[model samples]
Target: MSNESSVAAEQGTAPAAGASHNHNPSPNHTVSKDTRRRVVTASFIGNFVEWFDYAVYGYLAGVISTVFFPESDRQTALLATFGVFAISFFVRPLGGFIWGHIGDRLGRKQALSLSIVLMSVATFCIALIPGYATIGVMAPILLLLVRVVQGFSAAGEYAGASAFLVEYATANRRGLYAAVVPASTAAGLLLGSLLAALLSSVLTAEQLNEWGWRLPFLLAAPMGLIGRYIRTKLEDTPAFRELAEKDDGVKAPALAMFRTYRKQLIIATGAVLLNAVGFYVILSYMPTYLSEELGFGATESFLATTIALASYIGFIFLTGIASDKFGRKRMLITASVLFILLTVPAFMLLDTRNFLVIVLVQILLGGMLTLNDGTLPSFLAELFPTKVRYTGFAVSFNLSNALFGGTAPFMATLLIGMTASKLAPGWYLVAAAVVSLIAVLFAAETSKKPLLQD
Candidate 1:
């Protein structure tokens, strides 16, 4: 079927025979059983590919440091590698705004497809680019350019996918379906970490630095192709379709969000701080911490993080199921409180020399982080009406992530350097978690609310 027919079919029958808007009982209209399942699966897979492409950078940063800045000092080379990481984040808000508009106005399916394609091309380019030895400064400059493209593409991947899944699901299953986004992310991180570890183990350090590092980035092309195919088969969410039919879809969703949903924008931004900060701390930075701070080799650090992340994937789905059973607010509250209390202790324990203690700390920390990660997508998505849900979610999520999440490792390193103390970054995590807890208290409980009812 054509895209227009698919969108029309997704909108369902509008309010049957002149029924009043208030009288329409189905808040998101109605979705076919098959459409609903396809949307969820497609959302998960698209997000998976996006994250896998983005995260391979961090997992392979050491090799990237060598390739991109071959003659630079060790610190300078590492800084250049992370500079590319931060550069990607800087463009996320633009990605959020542009793609969020498409999601809100045109359709979520289109936005999802667009993001995957952009990310796939960017990742493939990174894999194929010549090194500093061959191309001088142009190599690193080109790498930076591709990273910007990645950041822009990834900006919409999570928020758009979550909003699509939540809008397509019944109210009772929103949390469970929304959790799929983060589950896919956790799965992606796990996959990337495992690939990095396996490659590092099988290949000598010289071989990995020389050429094996490109393999994971090249692999992203196929995953992106699979994601595009899955998303192509999926239908737009019922809520988005309904809004388009009513002429309620805003032409500029980002502007509508700032004008109409400003309060929600603030609250959602604040609520996501814990998710952004906590996730980056546990997933992206942990390997760095293990390798640099704890003096573990790269292979051991990867194994620990990979194991912890595998466990994190399980908790993500479990927390989502719990949110549906208990409520989103309660799960978030419990998570925030635990995170605030445990942040300092977890990091301190991780710093200890005992591997067993470090393993235990990782499990506890991963579980606490999962509490917010698993629920925030639905919690944030539910805060706004259909007309600006994507805008509200994408802008808030990406802005906070760019400002806080993307800078986490660099900030942590800076703080530790300045203080001569390893525990300083934990304070940052605790403080952010506290702010998130306060925001969660102010936001309304959305676990049982219908997607379009707000």
Candidate 2:
């Protein structure tokens, strides 16, 4: 016990035996496989539910446009829907700074617990809001208000969860464990897509616009309740606890990040662009892409996206294990290179309208997305010291997601409209991959390092 603290001192506040909680210390130090699995599952649930709420909105955008913007022209309504979607992302940086400060200054557990509560309430409220038929202009305004809550909370969820998971993990297995976050994200999206597909199949188009779109949003309540319980019952992560025990945490982490860790912050943000745009566009935005520009029909697109996302969840785990062995830079750089080489061909193949080909194309992009995303959270966590770890991860990751990821679908729709070419979106994806590729190539390999050693 004393020796453990001494070792922590030697390593500059290494993970303590556990926090000051009354629970068994077995879960804290020398983490048994069962302990690891249980802790990972707890942190993983909140992230899963958060992404589910987010994806349900993106997946139901077609119905949402009809319900919320009935008076607008088709394109205009669609634009407005996606525009609101983007607004949610735009507000995330504010959430990041607020939650990041709490995480760094207070504790990871506080930030993690509060975020799920906000997400649950906001997401459930979206289902209850009246459509344009009932409230006219107020419908879109109310929807926008709910989405704003969603964005604000989401900025805290993933970044905080990532820090939580990585901190709770055994040093060597950090990548494997952290991959669960992104995997959960895929699982959530897959669930949303499956639900959307089922609703589209069973319900009449009129029924779907009227009520079917509300079902997935309604599920948010139960899922969020479960997620919040899992997180609240668990203790805070060992990394944050060690910092707290030593009184080593920063006061204004967001500002300290700007003054001291600007270079790493910029690099991490650049690397995050690959994940933000690459994952969001391919999964969250693809169904709309398929239904509108590709003519796949709603059911076909939803089902295809579900299958692809299911595959993505599997690939994310595999890629995470590979990154631990092969190094993150190799996987990240390779992902970008492959994106540049294969994007146009993939888009061209997608234009075929064959369900089998479409599914395969989506699976390809999903695997490509996993290559970077599976490794990113842990990678970003390792890039900064504990004092500013949460702030650095939150700011860099959420800012990139806000600016690049949030705008991806809207940009894709705009690119296609402006150029009248399906290939334009692919080119955009390639461009995002390239920026991340250059950043990864210049960055040093970090797989073998200790947590937050930088």
Best candidate, lDDT-wise?
A: 2
Q: Write the per-residue lDDT of candidate 2 for residues 1-454, one digit (tens) a residue.
A: 5433332343233343443311122434455677667778887788889999988999998899999987767767778898999999989988989999998888888998899889989999999999999999999999999999999999998888888877777666778888998998888888888999999999999999888899999999999999989888777766676667667676889887887667778788899987888887899999999998887889999988899999999999998899888887788888888888998899999999999999999999989889989999888877667777888899888899999999888888888889989988899999998899877765666665555422
Which 10 residues in a row give candidate 1 its minimum summed lDDT? 7-16
- Looking at model 1, residue 26 earns an lDDT score of 45
Displacement of residue 346 (Cα, Å) in model 1 is: 1.0
RMSD in Å for all candidates: 6.0, 4.8
With a 3 Å backbone cut-off (N, CA, C), the pairs that clash in candidate 1 are: none
Quick one: best TM-score, which candidate? 2
lDDT of 2 at 300: 91
* Per-model tally of clashing residue pairs: 0, 0
Cα lDDT listed for each candidate: 0.82, 0.84
Q: Point out where model 1 deviates above 4 Å.
A: 1-29, 70-73
